[model samples]
Target: MACLKLDARALNGLWNADHWERELSDPRRICVGIAEGSDNLSAVACGWIVLDELQITVVAVDPEHRRQGLGRTVLKQLLLDASSAGARQAFLDVAEDNHGALALYGALGFHTIGRRSGYYRNGKDALIQSLELQTDIKLN
Candidate 1:
């Protein structure tokens, strides 16, 4: 729901967003999302962003909430926020088999900027995409 706007089930155990909470507490990496609701405190669309480059590192929505456009909403807001704060480029990596994710990123004005071969644990390829920073990058 954040980086790639993907669902938790689809993501399987490929990632652990909570484990990153401590890492994101740092100023360099950003994490943002809506609370999961009363008592959970866990968030929907937990995203990891590289503030300096506006790169999206991770994002996932709980399986129960899939297809609600929450993923898109979160991703869009993050990009907008990055732009507002000043970022000329947003980058990300995705498993090549994730066609849906590729499509969403394309719709968001992100384009393939590079590739890292043999990069996945399963030996699948990884596509590196980038969203051009339309505005000058500035992080104050």
Candidate 2:
């Protein structure tokens, strides 16, 4: 749920991270399926963006809300939003152990562009992937 997102506590800090917000602040930035009205307060994806470069900082659905397709919906929205913005591409770093996440990005047209060794606090590595955007299609 939104409450369980790593950025949950930093919700307020969003205003301070306004450089990204300045460009991502469109009320219609993206369509968040099941973004609200979940049984719990969150049951949604927690994300951020810089132009078309979207970041899936955290996405936690309430146990009660699992398997309902909310997670994928949120991811789709983030990708669409970034593509609609100006991002020539979008990138995310997923822990090597997170097979599900890797699959999601792969299914969404993201490709592993690089890797960061010991990128996690627990010494886990990370896969950095990106989705290239068509500049001609980017909106102002």
Candidate 3:
């Protein structure tokens, strides 16, 4: 899929096309995507709604499209949609060394709630961050 191509350029073995395909088929999953053309995906944010929570699974942006607010745009859309769908909170696990992602999440009001040691295949620690979402929350 288009996300797989962007994933190869932006992500590091986080999730594969097969895994994404399976997850995308689930009814509780929500995704927001931005594409330059029919075949060029610029950025994407995906999450799963569970009870009153939104579990942000992945956010990927093409390396060529970084630092242009694409990630923030898509993620904000995801959060808005999830809130509308009855999600009261949002959470995600970001690699400890992924400063860019940490900063983005921080700017979005997500704070570190926990950590997972050696969470990734590359042995990076994963910082669990969470945000309390309100139906009228303004994500800016």
Candidate 4:
């Protein structure tokens, strides 16, 4: 996996265009994890840090790479990096029907804080989750 500074082009490539402006205008609010392949990226995770909160904006793994633990690896590293960057808490919203993501976040110590009805374009509700970061906790 590759952790790199994401620019607008990279963010675009990773399927996160909705927040491109925010990510590009402020460098500190962006972190991207890439699993590089010989020809392209196999997985990607993007997040932002604002004040004491780390918001995970997007995470995607290629269809062929699903269920391989790549997403968990990326998210775990992103949380560790966020904590190191002074984030006291982490937040993310996952589609209510996305069992895989719910499981991953649950395993990482995130608990549902709230919900947003019809949050997704497809009319699916989003479950907001949060994790209190402890410096003493081991990420791996």
Candidate 5:
């Protein structure tokens, strides 16, 4: 997994290229997972540390790479890194219908905190979830 060196071009290689340049250029913290021995990215997670909270703006895995634990690994790493950076909590929004993501987050100790109606461009509700990071707990 790549962290500090992640850029828009690398992110675009895994998913849509549209407007990624601007998103990646933002000052917020970001993390990315790349397939070993290749330039292809398997997962990407972006967020920022605000006070004691790490507000995640995006977490995505290539469709082809889904169900392989790549997303979980990426998120786990991000949480650990953020916690080490002085973030005590982590938050993210997941589409209500995204069962895979919901399951992943749930397994990682995140619980629903609230919901946003019509939060997505597709008009789907978003489930807001948060996790208290135990920085001392190591992820398996």
Candidate 6:
């Protein structure tokens, strides 16, 4: 719902309503979202659980809602959900130039593991990062 509104504003049209519906229907997927109001979302984060690992698929914050901790809140909840689902670690690829995201991930204890050249449609390099999850980790 919120992601559908963000398709053009934040996701660059990489996903649609149907895509969200399908992913939401999957039992192995974890999604966390923060709503701005009854009909709008401020931030969202989602990941897929595979065995003991979590592959983070999406993390988006509406432009108007950036830099207000919404991204951090949703992501923390998503990671907690993944950990509760038996994920021992988490992984994600972020564009190299996305300083905000890199800072957020770093603060959350994610370390760079690899890089992919020209990984995005805009020719940006992707930095792969990973974080070890602890079932008892304090998120507050």
Predicted structure with the largest TM-score when compared to the true one: 3
RMSD after CA superposition, every candidate:
5.4, 6.6, 1.5, 4.8, 4.7, 1.8
After the best TM-score superposition of candidate 5, give how far the Cα of residue 11 lies from its true spot, in angstroms.
Answer: 11
Better lDDT candidate (1, 4): 4
**How well does candidate 3 score on lDDT at residue 115?**
98
lDDT tens digits, residue span 1-140, model 4: 22222322233354344455565457776555554654356666668888988998877666666798887877787888888899989888998998988988888888899999999777999999999988433455
| TM-score, one value per model | 0.73, 0.63, 0.94, 0.78, 0.78, 0.92
Clashing pairs in 5: none
- The lDDT for every candidate, in the order shown, is 0.62, 0.57, 0.90, 0.72, 0.74, 0.87
| Per-residue lDDT of model 5, residues 21-108, tens digit only | 6456665575656565565666777788888889987787766677888888888888888888889889999889989888888888
Q: What tens-digit string does per-residue lDDT give for candidate 1 at 41-99?
A: 22333334454577676656556665676666667767767666766578889888888
Q: Give the TM-score of candidate 5.
A: 0.78
lDDT at 126, model 3: 98
Clashes of 5: 0
Better of 2 and 6 by TM-score: 6
RMSD of 1: 5.4
The superposed Cα distance between candidate 3 and the true structure at residue 60, in angstroms, equals 0.5
Show where candidate 6 strays beyond 4 Å. Answer: 135-140
Clashes of 1: 3
How does candidate 5 score on lDDT?
0.74
Q: Model 3, range 26-121, lDDT digits (tens) per residue?
A: 899998999988889999999999999999999999989999999999999999999999999999999999999999998888899899999988
Worst 10 residues of 1 by lDDT: 38-47
Which 10 consecutive residues of model 5 have the lowest summed lDDT?
Answer: 1-10
